[model samples]
Target: MEVELEIKGKKLVLQTGTLAKQTNGSVLVKYGDTYVLCTVVAEKIPKEGLDFVPLTIDYQEKAYSAGKIPGGFFKREGKPTDREILVSRLIDRPIRPLFPEGFNYETQGIASVLSYGDENIADILSIIGISAALTISDIPFNGPVGAVRVGRINEEFILNPDNEESEKSSLNLVVAGTEEAVTMVEGGAAECSEEILVEALKFAHTHIKGIIALQKKLGSIAGKPKREFKVEHGNLKDAIFNIISGKIENALFLQKKLERQQALEALFNECIQNLNTADKDISLEIANAFDKVVKKIMRETIIRKGVRVDGRKPDEIRPITCMIGILPRVHGSALFTRGETQALVATTLGTSEDEQKIDSLEGEIYKTFMLHYNFLPFSVGEVKPLRAPGRREIGHGYLAERALQFVIPSKDEFPYTIRVVSDILESNGSSSMATVCGASLSLMDAGVPIKAHVAGVAMGLIKEDDKVVILTDIIGMEDHYGDMDFKVAGTEKGITAFQMDVKIPGIDYEIFKKALDQARQARLFILKKMYETISQPKELSSYAPRIYKIQVKPEKIRDIIGIGGRVIKGIIEETGVKIDIEDKEGIVRIASSNEASALRAIEIIKGITQEVELGRIYMGKVSRIVDFGAFVEIMPGIEGLLHISQIADKRIQKVSEVLKVGDQIPVKVIEIDDLGRPRLSRKEALKEIEGKNISTK
Candidate 1:
């Protein structure tokens, strides 16, 4: 059946009786020509006490939708791209939080793009499709959430603008929410003012409400009855009340931040310890309940009371300290700490040969710059087995990488392979932002001429009733209690990257704008502090290698390469330096540990390829001596015969008497054959010497 519904600010048309009818809950949704098919399926049985829902959201794009083909060996769908993973996260973020706690259902949400006009964004459409599917599916969810993409162009806000319109827009913000409040936001912007960001958010919320309403209307027609599920509320509730009421007086009066945490930990541990002496099976249950209770109280306290556990104001940033060039051996290094979140970021500069090669759907490619983020368990006061980077690490690294990508100089401009490594020494919240700050400082310290300094900040929000407070430079606690975690990163002129994840169905435009505005203010402050330490790029370290670039004629590439690359290899071994030669257009780049090595290599290259100049004396070896002339070898493969008459001013004897094979001689070039062979004369060499002697006298 075809269903039509209108909610908040969007109109959704879902046709279930037609397309993708095989899936459990498949609906083709149209939001103007941009179409998406959302399919949902649930596992027959849930894992015991999984606690959280196993909800996987996958957003895949078909090449045919954009009139392109898969460009790889497989020629079909493979692993997800970074773009797909990001879009999947976008669809998953708002929906994940909307599912009720303790609902351990294994559900999957897949939004596939069958047709795209390149006008509407697939992300916003996917959000609508997911909501529509869940509203109609037998799955239980506290949802009907709506999402919208808001942009600011020419000082005016636009909703669901086409791809072309988004290019000119300053902000690319996605806001998703229920009727009451927004739960998620994600966006990037030009360095817009705080007021402008706020206004854009408000505009988005008003329109998104319409989308939410549409989902509810669609559910009314095709929705299934929600299944009955137990929300576990055991005797732990009474135990939690007793513990909090008993300790509320002391917990509320706790002054020092660490002491408060210690006291809370002691209280929770005491409850667990007591439960351990009780029944063993119920002990696990009691511990889980106690942890939940403490978390609930902690969240409630932040929302009901104006105070934070860390004792900082909502808009106050943690103490920041930045230092550069901490590691003497590295090309560049910086230690950036905001509150407790610390990142030791280092930058290494290398030649083109050291550039990273990646195999992707687009085939093998070389990247000039790379950023890696490492989050060790010890950074967050935990211990666990070490493993490779998980999805979170990849996502975080890409976020920071995108933030700094715009400022990095192109390979042709900088001619250096750049690698940035961020190690989290301590993490509270927004450690990724610390990566950005550290990366910028480290690049500057390495003498990388970035266009401008970049900085990042994570803002948070707390909403109760109609009142909302936006927090700047949030800590771990604020993030846990907060409804939104909006991270913005950019240079002083414009935003480079942004990500927003909310705990509610969605946030309003006003809240998002306020958080972004606050983030900008905090970002600027952090940048200023960084500038105080080092305002501009310094000279590269003396230990760093020196690089030289040389371009040769395309036809001469083979000559320089010689047979089987023997010539270039010989040059490297003789000079004791590294050389990279591109044979396509004959561009040779030489890198050496010191200037002398580089210069020596350059000289050797010039001697082999440069044309012989007239009057230039070259030390040559006599190859064969005949009566008529002595043939002398000048360059590697060039030989010239000097006539016996030109061997001396007054020669009356055989040439062998004066010059024999393997005799070293100094020769002067007097003429060249039509074939461009050097004609050497021993008489001319003697005359030149006599002229120099006369001049000296």
Candidate 2:
């Protein structure tokens, strides 16, 4: 079966029943020659004792899809790349919420790129394929979600813009939704206004509806009967509520996260003891009942009295403190604390050699600015084995990096490579946003010359029937209970990065607009607090290596490099400096902690690449004597021919009669031949010196 639609003059094609027939559900999505094959499988029975579904989305990009072989030793794709992991999260976030509550089946979805045309990206197509596959299969799903990437290029919205178009665009907004409302939003912009973001959302939804209609058409003919699944609701709610009742609400009102958590744990213990049941099932029932009551009371209190768990208003932010230069040895360091969350961020400056190289399907690219986020087990007060960064850490780091990327200086403006590391010292909620704040401060502290101060805030939503409450600067508990987690980051001018994921089916336009506005206000407030500590970039740290830049003729690049880089390496060794030379533009960067060493390296490079000008005088050393002329070394690598006729006013018998090797004498560059060789005259240089001396007398 096939369903096709033309979006923004590009064809979107969906086909099924011809491949992966053995799987429970499978679909192949094609957009502008890029194809994604998505398949989903779920166990018939739920995992025993599992309260949540164990679903994993693996989105892999096969090298063969792009007509290239894998570069590594194994010659095949190994672990998931960061791009794959992020795209997998994109597909999982929207679809996971559509599954019925209490469906704890262990499910897995795999989206493989079958073809990479480079015209259309496979990310959005993967989401569409997964949604279509689940809709047609026996698996229970309440979705035919549509996704579109919206790009704005001159205030006009473009749907699913190609890679080239995306570069020219200011906004790269990916919106995913069911037919009725948007479910997920993830992408970044270049400091665009909030209203502009809203318009983009509305534009994306229009195209999204078309995608949903196409999915529905495919499902109508090939949809299978949903499997029989029963959601068991506990009847112990009333029975357990009598035991905890008024105590749960008071426990929730505790000011601190630790205190609130301890109070809840104590109440759960009391409730379990009051039941006094040896039966394990009764204890589990009591636990579930206690959770439901806590959730209900928290929501009710917030809606009725406009009070939060921490005794703040719905829009109130937590107390924040920003400190800089905390670490003496590092290039730049800052400690940003907001309520219980804190991030210790440090920045380091390096030369061009420190740039990161990324090999992807498109091509190889180098990144001069990098941000790394580390979340230790101790930060959350948990004990877990230390290992490589998990998916969550990478995702958080990428978001914070994107948020600050807009403000980072260009390579031409600031030649040094910049790296920012954010360590989560303490985490209750919004550690990622705290990282953004700390990173911005540290960049300024390192004298990065970023455009503006960037700040981030995590906004949340709690909806009960018609009552929707938008939360600003939410803590961990509110985030866990809320229906939406919307993170927005930017400068005071506009937004730079944004991501939103909702547990509910979807959110309408009104909620989206309100969430963005609230997030913007929160971000500005945080920026104001950050500026109180440090406003602009300061002087470069004493520990940082000073870089001196100079450009030479492109042809002279090879001369400076010499055979096997011997010439440049010699300069670095003699002066104790680091040198980077660009071949095309001949831009040489000399970096050294010692100012004298850097200047000396620059002098050596200039001498090696300098050209001799006609009619110019230079102090020359006679390097070799020949019958016709003598070779004089004017610069380090440049030599000029001083013929015997031009050596003196009258002709001499032999070149050695007037001058010999290793003689230092002033000479004039009389002429330069066609082959770029300079002819030198010692008589003319001596006459000019004599005339100047006579005038002074």
Candidate 3:
């Protein structure tokens, strides 16, 4: 069966009942030439005593989808790329919240890009595909969510903009929502205003509603009956709550996080002892209900008391302190601390040769700026086996990179590869936002000439019974328990990047607008503090390599890189410097610790490619001696003919007596034949020396 809907003048086709029939639900969605097949499977038997939903969303991209072979030793896709992991998270966030509570039947959804059209984006299409599949599946998902990519071009919003349309856009926003509310949003912009962003969301939601209607119609035709499930607390909730009721208030409000956690744990343990049920099955039931009780205590405390666990108002941010140029040897470095979270950021500067080269479906790309984040166990007050960064770390680093990339100077303005590394020394909450603050300060300390100070803040929300509270700079507890974690980054003027996820069904546009408005205030406040630490980019460090850019003829690139790269290798070895030459427009970058070496390399390049002047004198080496004349290399590769008669003032019987291979001699450019070759003379050079001697007499 197939269902087609037209959204914003584009056709979205969803087809099923043709492939992967064994699964609960499978859908193949195509828009333009792009197609994605998403399948959902569920284990009917629920895992016992599981509180959190066991849902996994996987988004994978095959190279063959774009008519290319995979590039690896295994000739197959290995671990998921950063792009794939993020997409999986995008699909998981909206759908996970819609499942009925206690429905822990181990469901897995997989969305694979079968064919990628150049004009269509696969990420959002995959997001839409998973939603359609789950809606028609037997799983209890209250979703028929729709996703679209919005772009702002010439002050107008474009829905589901393709690659070409996005190129001219100032905003690249992706919004996912059902007809009732918006669930997920992630994208970047060039200092977009809050009003424009809010309008864009509304615009995207209107079109998304149509897509949702199509899914509902499709689900009614092919959807299976949802399995029945019931979880019994078994009088354990009453027993535990009765014992811990008196102590919940004091334990929830301890000013210190550790103290509060300890108190809550001790009280919960006492309640467990009061139950005194030795049956393993009964004990498991009590344990599960206790978690919900704890969440209820936290949420009710915020709602009734109008204050947080840390004795903060709803919109209060944590304490902050920042410093720049803390480390002497590093090109740039800063230490930023917000509340208990701390990030020590270091910036390194390098030559153009240090730029990272990446191969992707789009094309080959070179990145000049990169931000890497490292979250150590010590940062979180725990000890574990150390390894490479996980998906969370990569996602955080990419977020910070997107936020600050807009402020970085272009290659034409400041031509150097920039690397910023953030090491989380202490973490409590919103450490990724702390990274954004630290990276901005470090860039200024390195004299990177950033446009403005960039800072980020995360906001949290609690919604129950038509009441909502937006918390700014929330700690770890609130983030894990709250319904929303909305992070916005930007300068004081406007936003640069936006990322948000909700754990509830969805939040209406009113809540969305309030979050954006509150974040803008926090962003400006953070920026004010950031400027007091480091107002602007200082002078470039003296220890950094001085760079000079030069351009030669496009055809001369290969000549500069001689046969087998010998000529370029010799230059670096002889001068002890680094050089990068680009085939596009013949851009050459020479970087050296000292100015003398750099100047020497430039002069060497000029000697080979520069034209020889008729009257200028040059020191040349006699490369070969023939019967007619001797070939003296005036420069590296430019040779001139020095006849035997021109070898000496006196008639020489053989040129070998005066000149031999590897002999250094001064030669003058006397004339050039019509063939554009140089004719040189050693006799004329000697005559000038004799004339000077006679004139002194």
lDDT: which candidate is best?
2
Clash list (residue pairs), candidate 3: none
Q: Would you list the rank order by TM-score, best first?
A: 2, 3, 1
lDDT by residue for model 1 over 460-565, one digit each (tens)?
8777777777788877767875777788898887687778788765565656666766777788899899999889999988777878888776666665667998
Please tell me which model should have the higher TM-score, number 2 or number 3: 2
- Clashing pairs counted in every model: 25, 0, 0
Q: Highest TM-score: which candidate?
A: 2
Q: Score every model by TM-score.
A: 0.78, 0.97, 0.92
- Kindly list the per-residue Cα lDDT of model 2 for residues 593-619, writing each as its tens digit: 999999898888889888888888899
Reference-based lDDT, residue 93, model 2: 88
Which residue runs of candidate 2 sit more than 4 Å off their true CA positions? 279-286, 694-697
Higher-TM-score candidate of 1 and 2: 2
Can you rank all candidates by lDDT, best first?
Answer: 2, 3, 1
Instruction: At residue 194, give the lDDT of candidate 3.
Output: 88
Task: Give the better candidate number (1 or 2) by lDDT.
Answer: 2
State the lDDT of candidate 3 residue by residue for 158-252, as single tens digits: 88888789889899898999788898888899999989998999998988898898888889898888778886547777778888888887887
Candidate 1 scores a C-alpha RMSD against the true structure in Å of 5.8
